[model samples]
Target: MGRETNCTEAADTLQRLREVPIEALVPVIDRSDPGRLGAWQPVIDGDFVREYGSLSVKNGDYPKLSLIIGTTSDEGASFSKLGLNTTEQIFDYPVKQILTAKIL
Candidate 1:
């Protein structure tokens, strides 16, 4: 499908999900395609996630405190794909993810 169409569908799905009971989401998540599942990132609700993480960090929008950055050993494996061999594809992935998040 075209990117715009996909984005629209994703936005619609998220809208519909708002009314679904929290318990109902488990089956929906389980049945969704592994990698193609909609963006599972934090929503940029104005009150909580006011802006992008990098922008918040750059502007010092968050509370001043000690920070920790760590990841699980196989965290990258969940996002691995076979055909993204080029630099552009690698970079484009996160941009698309950000765009999808914004659309919701």
Candidate 2:
């Protein structure tokens, strides 16, 4: 919900949020058919999160702390199932390439 911009825009957004009903602030998530739905993500304000966190590591911006990297087998399979057409198409998807680029 937090996005970076000029002061004017930020103030405007704050005003709108204040006027909007609290119920509207709740994100809608569809577990049954989750495609292009709300996601939990960090806002890149250029200070704490200057870029995609993974890209920062790949670019050698190692943090002064321990780190962890892993993913479950078939992590995106459920997502791909609902978002893609066929199994063949899923196999052809560039999931590996995208991960390699972000990690290496």
Candidate 3:
């Protein structure tokens, strides 16, 4: 079947990727998955990341130098639905309602 063939090809590709070094594969992964939502993911290599971001910060494993973190006003608009023209439309969005319905 078509599904089986696709699965075999995926397995072969995964095997090939596994054989490649991480240094060589990182650029390929970055190029292939610009959104970083694919099979490959970032790992805590104990040098840079060390652990989960929050945990690293809490344990003082992160840099102690001054750091400023900020985002633009429209940063969250990217994740919101399109056509949200008016303030009323943005406020009355069904995201909360949908989340509440799913949670309940």
lDDT of 3 by residue, 26-94 (tens): 455434533434244457878765688788778887678788688765545445566664568888777
State, as a TM-score between 0 and 1, how close model 2 is to the true structure.
0.32
lDDT of 1 by residue, 1-104 (tens): 12222333565765665656667665555444557534566779998788999999899888887887787653453366645645687678777877878988
lDDT of each: 0.62, 0.57, 0.58
What residue pairs clash in candidate 3, if any at all? none
lDDT of 2 by residue, 3-87 (tens): 3122245557777556655454443222234554424447787987889878887898866677768877654654565656556
Number of backbone collisions per candidate, in order?
Answer: 0, 0, 0
Ranking by TM-score: 1, 2, 3
Clashing pairs for model 1 are none
Winner by TM-score between candidate 3 and candidate 2: 2
Candidate 2 Cα outliers beyond 4 Å, as residue runs: 1-28, 31-33, 64-74, 83-104
Stretches of candidate 1 above 4 Å error?
A: 1-31, 35-38, 69-73, 82-104
